[model samples]
Target: MRLSARSQRLLSLVALLLALLSALLGGWGYVNDSAAVLLAAPLPLLIVLAFVFGLSQPDADD
Candidate 1:
């Protein structure tokens, strides 16, 4: 299924927000000495990157 341009943009925005939240949580965890949280923080960033990469790709129909 293809998303409209607006939907893609919205999805990207949400992904970014999630990444930001994850980073903040990671920072908090770092300050608190929680290794588990720190390790998990980067996962959302990877997901955001994936979303960005996927969105940047040209549609096969193009």
Candidate 2:
């Protein structure tokens, strides 16, 4: 199933917000020496990168 253009944009925005939050947490973790928080940070970033890449690709229908 295909998402509407608006929905896709919304999802992208949300993913970006999550990425920003992750970065902030990662920085805080680094300062606090929290290994768990540091390790968790990359996951959201990877997810956001994957999402943005997927959005950038042409759809099969196109």
Candidate 3:
């Protein structure tokens, strides 16, 4: 899928926020195992995958 420049920028920002949220949640979970397992477990991986996919997208001009 191709994204416009604005969309690309928006996705990048979203990816950044997701990463930060994942880290914060992971750290919080580390101090509280239950929270980590229940809340932060899949977020980091999911965010990473999203970032990868977003970056891998072919350019619209391509």
Candidate 4:
């Protein structure tokens, strides 16, 4: 199912925040030797990339 424009924008914003948080967590993990955080680091980035791509696409009705 497709999201409404507002929802899409919100999702992209949230994804961006998650990506930044993940980066911060990754850095913290590296400094603290936390393996779990390291493993999770890429997930948010992947999510953010997906949302960014989604945001970049022209809307279906466009």
lDDT of 1 by residue, 1-62 (tens): 45567776776677667556656766666435365455456667767665776678788899
Worst lDDT run of 10 residues, candidate 4, spans 30-39
**Residue by residue across 1-62, what tens digits does model 4's lDDT show?**
45667876676677567556656766766445365455456666667665776768777798
| Per-candidate clashes, comma-separated | 0, 0, 0, 0
Residues 7-56, candidate 3: write the lDDT tens digits: 76765676567556656877866546565455545556666655676788
Q: What stretches of model 3 exceed 4 Å from their correct place? A: 30-62
How big is the positional error of residue 38 in model 2, measured in Å on the Cα after superposition?
Answer: 9.1
The sequence of per-residue lDDT tens digits that candidate 2 reaches over residues 1-62 is 44566776776676667556656766666435365455455666656665775678677898
Prediction 3 global C-alpha lDDT: 0.63
What is the lDDT of every predicted structure here?
A: 0.64, 0.62, 0.63, 0.64
- Model 1, CA-based lDDT: 0.64
The residue ranges of model 4 lying beyond 4 angstroms of the native Cα positions read: 29-62
Q: What are the runs in model 2 whose C-alpha is more than 4 Å off?
A: 29-62
lDDT of candidate model 2 versus the reference: 0.62
